[model samples]
Target chain A: MASDRTASQPESSRGYAPASGPESERGAGPRAGSVQCTSRAAPAIGAPGHQAGAGPALHDLDQATIVARAQNGDVSAFEWLLSAHEGGVFRLALRMLGDRAEAEDIVQETFIAARRSLPDLAAPQSFIPWLYRVATNKCFNLLRSRRRHPAHPDAFDDGSVPAGSHDAFAWGEADPRHQGDTCGGLCQDPALRYEAEAQMRALTGLLQAVPAGPRACWLLRDVHEFSYTEIATIVHLPESTVRGRIARARRILAEGMQSWR
Target chain B: MAMNGGKPRLGCGRLIDDVWASIDQPATIHERSCRDCQSARAALDHLEAVTRSMRERDRGDAAQRPSSRVREAIMAVARAEVRRSRRVPLATTPLGTIDISEQALNDLIRFAASTLPGVRARRCTVLRSPTPQSSPGGPSSAGVVDGGDVRITLTVALSSQVRIPATMTLLRERVGTIVQAQTAITMQQIDIGVEDLYDA
Candidate 1:
């Protein structure tokens, strides 16, 4: 959305709301992240701090008081805390478990665990990593179980051959010159598009093949951009162990990705 | 290489796993110039591309979000957790003062902000600016303003189509008018923020 001081157009200037939704629907998050502002201006209720601009930085204001209230049996405060963290917890579970149904179950389990342990939580600053740590464990448990039950559904893969076994560019006898370019996703040429998609399928297989420990480290580092220390906290490992695991995961992934070249 | 399940593929040699895994490691001259390392590097690049591509697709899939039932269950638990009575005093009068809960006031603000053309007011923080004599750190309540000007700070997601300036003006006016009219609380500063643009 355009920022402050954008030219004020008359209502008439707003043409019939565009024919359809915005072309890109990326990063549309869950409603739980919505802030319920309670200003300290009133003696009866005060959530504290009315930030002029809105962003993650603004939302980062401590919820120590709210968390304290929740721990002391304030349902309202608990609700706000849950809402703020639920979507993120769910997303983490989805990515780690790779199954929507399983992720939902883990989300439920994570909240239950969080609620039980919240009173013991040291402070609001650690709330996010603490919550993530809970969800990550739930996802880890599910992954281990899925490994045992070979028949379990793997949303991670769908019968595509790994690119390491064949030429990724050779999709259904496709073009030889179609070098996979990461110039934003889909290619204009149908053959190149097919090749690109096949390569993605192969990579997905390799990702699923990664053991849970290294996979979490690699994903938290690469995709979620968690710091090594933060990751260690969430995974309950030494900082050095986290680094070594991430490096090892990368090495394994590099070998598996070789065919994409 | 043909598609064969049992056969091991001829893949890149050892540099990627042993040397490149720990990215902090500087590559030797041979490792940098070797045919296998170059191919390994490209493969690593492709690995990143694949993850990025997956995230993009996953982000677009809004349907994958948790169900409404989950939200309802959470709200149910939260509401059930509030055992104590809740009330907000609007004003004092000769007969009696009308009390409105904090949630009710916030609801009014949300309602006012939503009525504006193509705007969803999210995270509305209504703070009463401290009086000139009072310390800045003074605690302020939701409805018990104690005769100080009210400052409304909120984040809103704007529709992609509307003109931001006009909408912002409408938002400030609507919020101020509603808060004043509903509870006799006059607004001093209305801080409106545009957080994100949505398809509406």
Candidate 2:
């Protein structure tokens, strides 16, 4: 049943490298002293005196420039590249781990690995998927290790998996009691509807119950709109398998969400 | 700043958690003074705050406002990246030519100058054109000539201990090779500006 859906079909919502010390850059000759008014050093938004001149327009670059510079030990270039893509990457990790800090750590580890292997990046434009692959592997390893040592419990582990109990992990059912606190509304008025809070909690709970792989697959495919080929390349999975996982993940999510009615 | 620790204790994680939980919410002073505990508390506080805010926002219809300043900052980071990747000059002078777009040229000059024997220091910049001075010789009398196309110029700050003539020759030869090979820019002249002599 899971294998029937394509990876591109919206299933539902889903979703390091070592980082250099935040202050390193490589250059020729007397390195230009740190740019005092550099953008990274300042708050881009909501900062005082933030006129148009304060911000320079920066077009997003494909991975090739980043890989080349990083290979040559240009730490700053690599860092900028990291910052540019971190939001999407971080969001994916957060969706999977349900822990922001752990997701951050995974991102850091992913980059460290990427930096070490930058020389092997044949095409810079192809680096994003490659990077995601590396990061996913690291996260999976962390998950696997946590499984082996039960003491280090992930957000997903709630004693059900170990006992071979499947139903114990409920999905998409929000606690009416904490509905006010766990909602995920984008622009609905809080005072307008008390029930929306309950809906949000249920959505979050359902998202939390998704196993990491399917969860990742669904988020990448549905929320992020990555192509099946791209998802496959990143996850190191067969395209068909990616499709199946997403389908399964979505069915579970949809079924879990059905209770909201 | 090292904490007191003799023998290592096993199950330290559990012990720490237990002790941490037992503390009646710490006074502001106590929390602020301890780095480790403070970090933990801050993490928890941040998580709680973020989650709470997210929930509150989810309950409302407030459009997520794009912070112009933050957007600008992000743009700025991207711009700095562009500048970093380009061949650009830190500063320009009247005598030297600076091309901010060529990393190859910068690397070549820096590498060549560093290799010059006894040349302990180096820096490079482009010279700005000087304003014309009125003299009897009309156009020639005006000192300003558009020298931008003449050559790729480099100003190397050298050490006083080195033979200026010999070092200059060696620098010209080596820098010329590196620049041509890396950037494909043939140089008509490599103007070596001796900014300051480094003490041995």
Best by TM-score: 1
lDDT of 1: 0.54
Top lDDT prediction, candidate number: 1
Clashing pairs in 1: A38-A47, A40-B140, A41-B140, A41-B141, A42-B140, A42-B141, A43-B141
Q: Ten residues in a row with the worst lDDT in model 1 chain B? A: B1-10
Candidate 1 lDDT, B86-174, residue by residue in tens: 34566779999777654455556766776776665554555654445555677534325443354656665566678766566667778
Q: How accurate is candidate 2 locally (lDDT)?
A: 0.45
Writing each residue's lDDT as its tens digit, candidate 2 over A1-261 gives 111223321111111111112322222222122211101110111111111110121112112323444454443445555544555555566667666677777766666667668668765445667777787777777777786787866533221222211322322323344333323444266653355556545555666666667777766765555667888888887876676566445444544544443
**Cα lDDT tens digits for candidate 1, A77-179:** 5665665556556666766776777777777777766776876885533566777788888787776677578886443221333344333321121123433
Give the Cα error of residue A183 in candidate 2, in Å.
Answer: 11
Restricted to chain B, the TM-score per model reads 0.52, 0.39
Query: What residue runs in model 1 are displaced by over 4 Å at the alpha carbon?
Result: A1-88, A144-180, A183-198, B1-28, B83-200
Q: Write the residue-wise lDDT of candidate 2 on B82-173 in tens digits.
A: 35443333235698755545433443455555565554212333333443455565655122323332244443334435665556666666
Query: Candidate 2 versus the native: TM-score?
Result: 0.43
